[model samples]
Each structure stands twice: as structure tokens, then as C-alpha cells.
Target: MTWEEIAKAKKASVDDAIPSEWRLEKNPTANKVRNVGEYLDETLPARENSITSCTVTELAGKISRGELSAIEVTKAFCHRAALTHQLTTCCSEIFFERAYKKAEELDEYFKKNGKTVGPLHGVPISLKDQVNLEGIDSAIGYVSLVNKPKNKDEVSNIAKILENAGAVFYVKTTTPMAMMSGCTSSNIYGYTYNSYNRLLSSGGSSGGEGALIGARGSPLGFGTDIGGSIREPSCFHGLYGLRGCSNRLPYCNVTNSFAHAPVLASVIGPMAWDLDDLKLVTKLIIDSEPWMDDPKVPPIPWREVTDYPKKLCFAFVSDDGAARPHPPIERALQMCKDALVAQGHEVIDWEPPVSFIECRDLGASIYGADGYKEIADECAKSGEPIVREVMVLAGNGTDLPIGCSHVHEHWEQNKLRYEYQQKVDKYWKSTAQQTSTGRPVDAIITPLWETCSFKCEDIDMFSSAYSSTFNILDYAAVTTPVTTADKTLDSKDETYTPISDHDRAIHEYYDPELFHGTPVGLQVVTPRYEEERAIYLSGKLRDALSERR
Candidate 1:
């Protein structure tokens, strides 16, 4: 079969896997279905609607107490997931039958044992396509990888961990080819649109995960991040996503590109509609001692952080010094600052010792250290053209970057990354002298992107400096939704002058009307291995914002 035939068949298989009863009679277009979550709320049966509306913690509690059966919960999510995929193209693989069977088994275990199997007993969890499952394809948007199923030995460690805790998996979310792009568009899945506003691009790599969870197709899901794959999508859809320090969460057996790259690594974490749900899963995974299974994972047990100074200090990064944030992002930052101040928390300007510009450039150099040869070879296998959005990673959008000429060049990038981390760490510590509490600021809050999101075709014009800088520092960051883009409030600044050509393009791309209704989110970043603190601070931020609301 031709590559086009393979891609079509793969997509058809996912659709075919959905039961006819669950399929939408007429799939809605972006214009007609701007917000799928709301659409589903009004259209779904009352029971399914209520079930999908509950947070992961609520669902688990109901299932544990016999108020809801595992099969029932699974059915609700599976149905919603089927509809979400049809509307957003968010799913790469759908196997509701398998999920049902597992749910039944879990129910039987509960009946015989007189107790829940685990903390996550019977909870439905969605996974990115890179998460391998036995007999399922983790093709990750490569037509050449279609039809190749993973073996039992190849299952991702994260999947195994979740399953052991009685989680049921029905669908695998879509990803870009080789998981190398910022927007989720590939030859196979085409594109995964934002769930809240289908007209916008779902932030990539984990774009499908973002869209699915944004639409509440599943209570919670997992997304990986080397460079904002998880945070961008979460921010785009108004969800909470964790990008823990490198190897803080197990990545063992997960399919990925640059798997052997020594200079940088990707980490997998949870994305959810509720902060508590995100906390529950992150702690559960850490409590499971995943390090015992994945040697790379450090044996740092989940730290439950509760005691913080009544008057906390926080560092706020308004811009990256190159590209200024669009109107909505700027307003969101002000909202956060005002909320924190209202709560008696200190909000200080953050001027890191290492420039974000340097971090971004270093990240790009390391990302293209091999000139993306693996990506090219994989696409070449099936004679498919590289997706345009991903072309920039190759070089100048027209040619592949020349890989490092020597091993020493690769070492230099690694050295620079380490140096940047050291500088930032020192600066964070130095802030204690400026803080009223004589302690370093509790966390640094910054924008996830210059704009909340952009049109699907304009993805190539955006820069990732806002998100990827943390990746270079190996910091733990959590995305928190603050507000929506409001045309009446967030107008483009005509008086501002661009500092650079890249900045000019980003500045000129802003249109209040076009970006209106999208979610504007920011990231709460903590030091490496401080996932607990990062999440705690995010909860604090949410509380402050809620009080204001």
C-alpha cells in the first residue's frame, strides 16, 4: 500500500474501533463546535455527562464506595473519548472493548476481594501515542511506523505502573511525527485542534492529549515533555500539566525520538482538568517507587509540601527580553500578580542570571545536534514529506541542519546547558537577600506562550523561548489557567516597537478578535526535583485567583 493508503487505513481503524452507537451522527466543524466540552455537556446523556464531569479523585471515590461501577465509569469515558476524537481528531488508537474488559475484571476483583484494587482502581486514563501498549501501535504519526505493533516487553513503564494501580486505558492520543513539532499535525492524524476553540491549533507533541482532556474525554491523561510538549497543550486548553525535572517521572520503554541523546531528556507527567487530580496521579506514581523499575529515575519519594510562609514571595517574569507577550498573556500576568498581592504574597520581578534567549538557542542546538536525521530517515522510509510545522527543526525550513561535525561539539552543548542551570540556580538563591522573608522566592511564574494559542497554519511563526528555557534548566514546572483572551480587554499594542525580526513577527501576529475565547495560562516553576513544591505553589495561585473571582 502507498503511504497515503496506510495513513488513511490507520485513521479508519481508530474510527472503526468506536462502537457505532457512540459515533457522532454528524461531526461538527470548528466554526460550529468552538468548545467541545460544553457541546458534550449539553448533548450527552445525563449520567455520562455527570460521570465525565467529575474529577479523577471524585470518580475514584465513587467507584471505591460502590456508588459507581468500574464498567460504568469506563463506558462514560470511552463514549466521550469517541465523540471527542471525532470532533478534534485527538485520538490515535481507540479500543473501548479492551477498556470494558479490564473494567469488568476490576469490578470482579472488587466483588471477590471486598476492597478496591488500588488507589486508581477502575479510573480511566488516556495516554499519548508514544506510550507503548502490547499489540497497539505507538506509531506517533509516522506512516512508516503504521501496522507495527508493540510486544509485551515493549510496553511503557508508565502504562505498566498505571495498570498495576487498576487504571483502565481505552485510547492513545495523537502526536506529531517523531514527536518533534510544536503543533500536533502529521501525515497520519492531520491536526489536533484546541478543544475549547477548534479554530486554534492544539499545542503540540502532546496536542492530542491536551485536546482530549480539555474536552473531558478522560478524567486525566499523561503527556511527555522535553521542551514544553506537555505544558503548551495544557496551557492552550486551560488544563494543569506537569513537566517535572528530568527523570523525576519514569520514561522507561516510552517510544520517542532522540532516545539516545545524552545532552537532554524527556519527562512524562500528568495533565488534568483539576489540580487535585494532577496531584493525586503525580503522588501515586511517586509513591509507587517507580525508580525501582526505571533505573534512570531518582529514588526521590513524593514530598507532601504543606507548610509555606503565610506571606510568600514569588518571582514574576513578564517577558523573555526578546519577544514580548501578546495582550492576553500580559493581562494574565497582571491578574496573577494582583491576586498574589491581594493574598499578601510578594510579587517581585524576575531577572534571571542566564538569559532565556541563550537557553532557547542552546536548546535548539542540542535538539538539532544530530540534524534530525532520525526524523528524516523515518519519513523517508514511507516516502512522506516532513510536515511544514516541523520543518524548522531540520534547519531553515528548507534544508536539514548539518549535524555536529565532531563529538566535542555535542559535548560543548551539554556543557553550556549545565552552565546555564548553575547560573539560574545561583540567581534564585541570591533573591533571598531581596525578599522580605529572607528566603528565595517560593516560585517563578511566567507565560507559557506569547499568545494563548495561534491559528493552525501560523504555528511555524511562533517561538518556544517562553517554554523551552525551563527544559534547558531541568526545572519542575506546572501550567495553570488564569483567564481567557477577551477582545474587549486585550488589544494589540500598536505603540510597542519590535526588538528583533522574530519579535516583530510575533508582535504583528496578534489579533484580539482571532485569539479571543482561547485560554491564557502561565507556568509555575520550581527548582529541579521540586515537583511537590511546584504543585503546591500552583494550588496557592489558583486559590488566590479564585478569591479574586
Candidate 2:
């Protein structure tokens, strides 16, 4: 078949998977749907909506005790997710019938044994399309990869672990072409819009998972990150996302942009609607002991750290020296600071010892080491043209891979990264001098992005200094939503001065009305490989903010 025929056939197969009753009378366009959750509330039965709103921990308890059957919970989510996909274009693959059958099998097992198979038994889990599943195509937004499915032997370790823990895989979400853009769109599956607003982007490359979770279609989802792939979307959609250190999670057999690019390794992590749900899935995955099968995974069991100081010392930065955040983001940071102080925690000002811009540039060089050549080769395999979103991020506004030809340069880059890490570690230790508790700052809070949301493909490619810096440092970080953009209170300030040309452009584009109601979030970061600390502080911040309500 010609490349065009292959693209059409691939899309047709996904379309065929949808049930006829779920099809909309009119196809949704860019400005058609505003709030997908609201749409489902008005259209779906009240019982189904209530089931969808239950948290993962709550659903697990009810399902395990037999008060609620797995079949009932899975059926409600499948129904709600169907309508969510129709309105948001968030799904790349769907199989609700098979999922219901799987859920029924779980119910039968519980009835026979009087116990659950695992903690997540009967729970439906969504995954990014890059995860290799047996007999399912993991196209990852590339037309050339649409028809080739992985064999059973080649499935990812994460999928197998989740399956044993009783997770029923029913759907895979959309991604941008080559997973290279900050917004979701591709030649294969088109575009995925934000769940709350049609005019705004659902931040990528894990954006499809974000949109699905934001719409309450998936209680727990998995997404991979090399840069801000996991964190950005979670912040944009008001969810919890953890970007763990490299080699911490099971990441084998997953499709990625580069085959063996070695500078900055990608990490696989989870996204959830709430902090408890996030910690629940994270602990379960670690408790499975993935290191036994995958060599890349560290042999670390789940460890609980229960020693947070009663009077903790905290530090935060609302604006990175590079760019001024939009008003909503600034307000979110202030809310976090005020809440932390009110809870008997002392807050201080902090600027990292390392330069975010320099580290981010090194990260980009690592990503582009082989650059567009790989993406071009994949596109050539099917003669599919790269989408505008991918092209706009391709440095010079075209589809050309960068040339990183110096091996010695890469070696030197690694050395410089280590130096930066050491300097930052020293600075963190010195913080005890200023703290009344005489303990180093527990965690640093910062803005997740320069803006709450952006129009598709209109964002600056180099705007990742705030989020990607943590990736470069390999520090563990988790994002949690604080507030939403309010047009009345988060209005524009005309007295701001531009920090740079890029900052000037971003500042000039601010419109309070356009971004009103968009979610604003911040990240709590700990040193490398301290995911336990990250989780503890994130929950603390969540509790502090909850008290304000």
C-alpha cells in the first residue's frame, strides 16, 4: 500500500474500535467543546459520573471489599472515556469491550478466592502510545510505525508489572509527531485539545494522558519524560506528575525518538488526578521489584521516610531570572508561599547555584545529537510529512536534524554537568546557616512554566528552562496544581520590563481573558533519587493548600 493508504487504513482501524452509540452527531472541531467533564455530566448517567469521580484509592477499597465490583467501575470509566475521546481527541487506541471482559474475569477471581489479585485489581490504567503492547501498534505519532505491532516477548516491563498488579489496559493516548513537540498534534491522529478549554493546547509529549486524566477518563496513567514531557502536561491540566531519575523505573522496550542517544536518559513515571493516587501507583510499581527483570532499574525497594521536621524551613522562587511568568503562575507561587507560612513553616528566597539556561542548552544538544535525521528517516519510511508543531520546534523552523559530530565535546559536556551538580549540592548544604531549625531547606517550590497555557505551536521552543532544568540536574520533582487563572484578580501588569527577546515576546502575548480559568501549578523538587522526599513534601503542600479552602 502507498503511504497515504497506510495512514488512512490506520486511522480507520481506530475509528472502527469506537462503539456506534458513542459517536457524536457532529464532529468536534477546535472551538466546539469547552469542558469535557461538564459535557459528560450533562450527557451521561449520574451513577456513571459518580463512579468516574472516585479516586484510585477509594475505588480500590470498594472493589476489594466486594461492595463494588470491578466490572461496574471499569464499565463506568469505559463509557465516560468514550465520550471524552469524542470531545477531546485524547485517545489513539480504544478497546472497551475487551476491557469489560477483563474486568469480569477479575470479579470471578475475587468471588472464587475471596481476595484481590493485587492492589490495583480491576482498575483500568491508560498508557502513552509509545509503550509496547503485544499485538498492538505503538505508532507514537509516526505513520511508518502504524501497522507493525510488538510481539508478546517484546512488551515493556512496566506493562507486565501493572498487569500482574491487576491493571486492565484498555486504551493508549495520543502524542505529537516523534514525541518532539510541547503541544499534541501529528499526521496520524491529528490534534488533542486541552480538556478545559478548546482554544488552548494540551501540553505534550505526555499531553494526551494529561487530557484523559483531566477529563476524569483515567484515574491513573503512565507517561515518559526526557525533558518536561511528564511535568508540563500535568501542570497545564492540574494533576500530579513525577519525573523520576534515570534508571529508577522500568523503561525497556519502549519506542523513543533516538535509538541510543546517551547524553540525557528518559525516565518513565505516573500521572494521577490526586497526590494520594500518585503515591499509591508509584509505591505499587516500586514494590513489584522491577529490578529483577530490567537491568536499567535500580534494585531499590519502596522506602517510607517519616521524618519531616515539625517546623520545616522552605525556600521558593516564583520567577526564574530568565523569563517573567504569566500572572496566574505568579499568583500560584504566592498562594503556595502564603499557605506554607500559615502552616508554621518558614519560607525563604532561593536561586539555584547552577545556571538553568546553560544546563538546558546542554540538554538540547543531547536531544539533537542525531537530531532530525532520525525523525526524517522515520517519516521517509512512510513518506509522511512532519506536522507544523514538530517543525516549529526544529530550531530553524524546518525539519533538519542538528549535527552533534564531536565525540569529545559530548564527553566534556558530561563533565560540566557533574560540576554543576556538585556546586548545587554544596549550596543546598550551606542553607542551614540561615535556617532557625538548623536543618537544610526541605524542598524548593518553583513555577512549572512561564505561562499557564499556550496556543498550539505558538510557544517558544527554548521556554523549558523552568521545567527542563530539573531533568538536566537529574533531580526528582513532582508537580501539583495550586489555583486557576482568574480574570478579575490575575489581570495583566503593564509595569513589567522584558528580561530578554524571548521574554519580551512572551510578556507581549499576555491576555487575562484568554487564559482565565486555566489551571496554574508548581513543582516541589528534591535532590537526585529522592522520590520519597518529593512525594512527602508534595503531600504536605497539598494539605497546606487544602486548609486555605
Candidate 3:
């Protein structure tokens, strides 16, 4: 079949899942609407409207108290998600009927047994296209794989764990082809626009999840990150995104870009309306002891703590000596620093432990582990031309997969990654000497991207040093939105000069008007395998920061 035919059929399958009663009477995408949530509130029935507005914590509490039924909550989210998809084309698949059925079952269990299903009993959780939902296709934006149901063992453990704990699944969001771009786009489902701002990108790989949550379509969703797939979208869409050390969550059974990437394996994490939901979801997953099912998962339980010193130390990284952040991102960093300092925390400049440019480039090389052969083969399977956003970055096919000739360099890449991790680890430990609290700095706050948002395919140069370097170091990190890219205050400075050619190219795209009102966020990072502590402190910092409110 022609690529166009395949793409059309895939979209039709998704559209067929939406009940005609829930379909949007008018498409909102054709006009200018600043806030999708406000539109949803005013347009949807008050019953559905109120249900979709509750946060995960509140929704769970409401259900547990018998104030709201699971079916009502699920129906509300499904309808809101439908409206959100109509406005932004954010979803790649929809299974609202199944979600409603699950909700009904939960309600029946509650009526008969007189107890909630689990911690997330009635919550409507969404997922990225790369995450398998049994009986449904998790194609991850490949037309060739459309309508192919995932195998039982091939389903992600996190999905199974969440489902077992009473979380209802309704839809899977869009992802870029091979999940390799800085913005989400593909020949199959098309581009997913930012939910808040229509003209700018929603962010890549996990962009669809970001847009969905940002619009309040779903209170919580999951996204995976090897580089900045999870965090970038979280930052752009004003959600809390968590990416922990490898296997801190479960990695088994998800669809991946390549068959194997043990060298720098990607981690699955959550994106939510607030830190409360983020912490709640992480705790539930850890409590389930996922290591039993997927041996790759570390047998670490969530470390619950309530006490933290009032005075703490932090490292602020505005740039990695490669791509300096644009004015808005820099302002966001400053806002974070000022907020912490005002609350009596010590904030200082941090010269990175290793060359970010070197580590980031090395990281990019690792992404091509199979010489793009896997993604290349997938694209070839459907004759789908690589989308513009990722064509130049990943799929032009310059490098070949592992071969006898390339064995030496492949091994060397592993050595460098290990060495880089050690250097950063040592540097992190050395911070004890520089802090008044007499411990290594609690966390490092840095820019997620150079600017708030960009137009489709506007990026020419890229670096994931700020976020990916943590992936290399195997640290735990959380992205918390700090402020917005307001044209009035985050104006570009005429006297500013780019630090590098790449910096100049990225900086040139910083039009405050274009990025106005887009969310600006920073990454709060902690040492490796410290998911519990990382989330705790990040939440503390988030609460202390006035701008975050």
C-alpha cells in the first residue's frame, strides 16, 4: 500500500474509537485560543468539566470517599481528551470505551467489596505511543506497525503495574518516528501542536503526552527519556517530568527505537499536573517491587522522608559552554535561583564536571548504536520519508550499524561514557567542600532548553548536554516549570553575543513574541538512583519557589 494510504488508515482507526456523542461539535484548531483548559471548562458539560479538572491526588481522594465514581472520572477524562485531540492532534490512538469499561468494573468492585481498587483506583492515566497497551497498537509513529497488537510479554511492566494498581488507561499519545526528534511529528499521525500555544512546538518524543496534560486532558501521563524526551516536553508544557537512573522504573516490554541499547538504556518516568501526583505515582510503582517481574528493575523501594534542612546548597547551570540558553530560559534559571536564595538556600554557579559538548556529542553517537539501521529499516518498511524535524538529525543514514570494522570505536564509546560518569560522580561528591550544610549539594538546577518554544523544524543546532548528561551520569532528575516566556520581560538583548555557532543559530530563534506565555522550566538533578530523595527535594524547592505558583 502507498504511504499515504497507510497513514490515512491509521488515523481512521484512531478516530473510530471516539464516540460520536463525545466528538467536538466544532474544531477549535482553526482559531486562536490561548488556553485549552479554560476552553474545555467553558465548553464541556459541568459534570465532565469538574471531573477533568481534578488533580490525581484530589481525584483519588474523591473516589475513595465515594464522592465520585470511577466511571464518572474515566468518562470525564475521555471526553476532555477527545476535545484536546481535536484541537491539537495530540493523540495517536484512543481507547475510551475500554477505559470506561474498566471504570465500571472498579465501581462494581467498590460497591461489592466496599474498598477502592488501589491507590490510583479511578485515575485516568495516559501513555506515549512507545508504551504498549495490550490489544492495541503502540506503533511509536511507524505506519508499517499500525494495527499490530503488542504481545503479552512485550507490554511494559510499568503499564501492567499501573493497571494492576487500579489506573485506567484511555489513550496513547503521539511520538516522533523512532522517538528521536526534539519535536513530535511523523507521516502517520502528523505533528502534535503545543496545547497552550498553537504555533509553537509541544516538544518531542513525549510531546503528545505533554500537550495532553498541559491542556488538562489528563492529569497524569507517562513518557520515556534517553536524552531529553520526557523533560523537554514537560518544561515546554508546564508539567512535572521525572527521569530516574536506569531501571529505577521498569524498562521491560516497551517498544523501543532499536532492539538493544544496553549501553545507554532509556528510562520510563511520569509527567503530571503537579509534584504530588509525580511523587504518588513513583511511590506506587516502587512499592510494587517491579524487580520481580523485570530483573532489569533495581529492587529499591521508595524512601519516604519528611524532614529536610531549611538551608541547602544548589548548583545553577545556565549553559554547558556549548549552547547557552536564550533570554527566557536564563530568566527562568534566575527566577529559580532567586526563589531558593530568598528561602535561605545557597545557590552558586557551577562549572560542569566534564565538557558538556564532548559528553553530549558522545551521547548522540551512542544513539546511533545501530547506525540508524533499525529506524532506517522501519522507515523503509513503509516508504515513509523521514519527517523534516528529525530527517537531518537522525535518519539521513550516515552511519552504519555495528560491524567488524566499527567494533573498536563502538567499544571506545562505552569506555568514554563510563569515564564521563565517574568524572561527574566525583565532581558531585566534591561539592561537600563548597557547601555550608557539609554535604554534597542537594541538587543542581539547569536549563532544559535554550528557549521556551520554537516553530516546527526551527531548530538547526541541538545539544542535550543539560539533561542528557545526567542520563550519561545515571542521575535522577525532575523538571519543574518556573515561569513563562513573557514578551514584556524576557526580551532579547541587542548587545548579546552567541557563545558558539550552534548557540547563535538557536539564539536567533528567540522571539519573545513567538514564545510569549510558553512555559519555562529547569531541571532539578540528584545523584544516581536517588529517585525518592530527588522527588522529595524537588517538591520542596518547587513549593519554596514563588514563581512556580
**Which structure among the candidates has the greatest lDDT?**
1
Candidate 1 lDDT by residue in tens digits, 1-549: 889999998999988998988878887777877999999999999999999999989988999999999999999999999988999999999998899999999999999998998989999999999999999999988999999999999999889989999899999999988888889999987989999999899989899999999999988999999889999999999999999998988999999988878889988999998999999999989998999999999999988896767999999998988889999999999999999999999989999888888898898888888777888888899998888878865557766764554789999889899889899999999999989988999899999888888888887787768789999999999999999999999988899989999899999989887788889899999999999999999999999999999
C-alpha lDDT values of all predictions: 0.91, 0.85, 0.84
What TM-scores do the predictions have?
0.98, 0.97, 0.96
Give the Cα-based TM-score of candidate 3 against the true structure.
0.96
lDDT of 2 by residue, 1-549 (tens): 887788777777777787888777886664555767777788889888888899899998999989889999998888777778877778888877888898999999999999999999998899998988888888989989987889999899899988899998889999999888888888877778888776788899998999999889999899988888999889988899998898788998987887466767888999998889888888988888889988888898888977657888778886767788888988888898889899999999886678777777777776676666788888888898878777776676665764655788777777877887888889888998888899889888988788887887575444667777888889899998899899999888899889788888778878987887778889999888899889889989999999987
Q: Locate the minimum summed-lDDT window of 10 residues in model 3.
A: 396-405
The weakest ten consecutive residues by lDDT in model 1 span: 396-405
| Clash number for each model | 0, 1, 0
Candidate 3: which stretches are off by over 4 Å? 29-31, 395-405, 547-549
Q: Rank order by TM-score, top first?
A: 1, 2, 3
Structure candidate 3, residue pairs in collision: none
What are the candidates' C-alpha RMSDs?
1.2, 1.6, 2.0
Candidate 2 ranges with C-alpha deviation above 4 Å: 28-32
Clashing pairs in 1: none
- Candidate 1, superposed: residue stretches over 4 Å from native: 402-404
